[model samples]
Target: MKNLILSTAALALTAGIAMADTVRMGTEGAYPPYNFINDAGEIDGFEREVGDELCKRANLECEWVKNDWDSIIPNLVSGNYDTIIAGMSITDERDEVIDFTQNYFPPAASAYVGASADVDVTTGVVAAQTATIQAGHVAESGATLVEFATPEETIAAVRNGEADAVFADKDFLVPIVEESAGELVFVGDDVPLGGGIGLGIRESDGELRGKFDEAITSMKADGSLNELIIKWFGEGVPTYNADGSVVTN
Candidate 1:
């Protein structure tokens, strides 16, 4: 939470000014490529870069707040931060409670990975990070869902035989599977999920959301957003056209 030195009455007088001057960006610092604590104990990753750039473009001073994934949304609602720039997908369910900027990322797939390609994901035990879209999908897909509070724990469950497979964002799983050295392999078809990742904000902060929305629009129009996407996620990932539509192979 941000600290303001004003008395209650004074704060009420300048609430909008305070909201515009300094913004707190919240994220699950455990999710890599989106966010993670570096060896130096500071936040680093794709979202870090994007958030900083967006803040610069929007002419806002911003600081990052690390929070556990399971409680990220609740904290946002309780005013722990001014915005959620985590790799949060734009979903109707979440939108009911908060507003989202236009997507900065193209739609991505959720994938299943197991010890082998033959492992059944349809009816077998599946691990997913709690409070994620993937977990909800697993629960409704007839797979026995075992949820963990963190993404690392979900992967650990699969490794320790607690789960037959782990389902999560394909971008997150790709590097893990590669480094697993054959211990883990992709299984089942990729499932497209959500409406792409966007900045999450309180519904009441429409002005703040609009600032970010315009900044994102500028990035997409100038192709810098696509450059950052390729820089972090590598080639072959979907990118945006000049007109802001997705360019997929």
Candidate 2:
């Protein structure tokens, strides 16, 4: 009877633990070094670190979900997960629908193109994150444009000579096209997409929102944040303030 009681108690404890676990979360499995799935089918990257830290701040459990870059928000709003831990930009447009935690890792904006060509300030630009802001600037200043997509696709385009350039997050590009040397140059960090990535929770989760903002700010100040950035982005890229202002190392 003693052995049977012990076994029953173990089962009950396990059930209780499951109930207390935090809600699910997700991100695109494409952005490398930032967030991607391992061979073991687990989500891992810089963003994973952010997610873990956010959960710790909120004192909530976490379970990572994986999906494409494009579908992250739509799925999130449909109740697929409690939040999107993806390296998603928080635009004024997006903010109208969902709430965002304070800026955690604000990657600088940089452009990439063929390893051989000069920076084409003439062709204007195209951005991976969308030109909703840059578009207005370019229209006012006058520039050129090409297609836009993931870095994988854009790099491939450059290789195939289909596109002239690719504007992207400076953190990832500094290393990805490193071999290209002159072929890939970081033209500028002037894009309108500022504020880096955010922890996207539902607008209604006010308590969770406050906790995440606190956690993110602390992580950045304590050096743990910079450690992860160096591990993936090397020592070149700068973490910016929310409005695209440069922050010193």
Candidate 1: segments with Cα more than 4 A from true spot:
1-18
The total of clashing pairs for model 2 equals: 4
Off by over 4 Å in 2: 1-20, 119-121, 124-144, 181-183, 186-192, 236-247
- TM-score on alpha carbons, each prediction: 0.92, 0.75
lDDT of 1 by residue, 191-219 (tens): 99889999888777888989999999999
lDDT, candidates in the order shown: 0.84, 0.59
Backbone clashes counted, model 1: 0
lDDT tens readout by residue for model 2, 12-74:
111112223586777776677778878988888888876887678668888888866555666
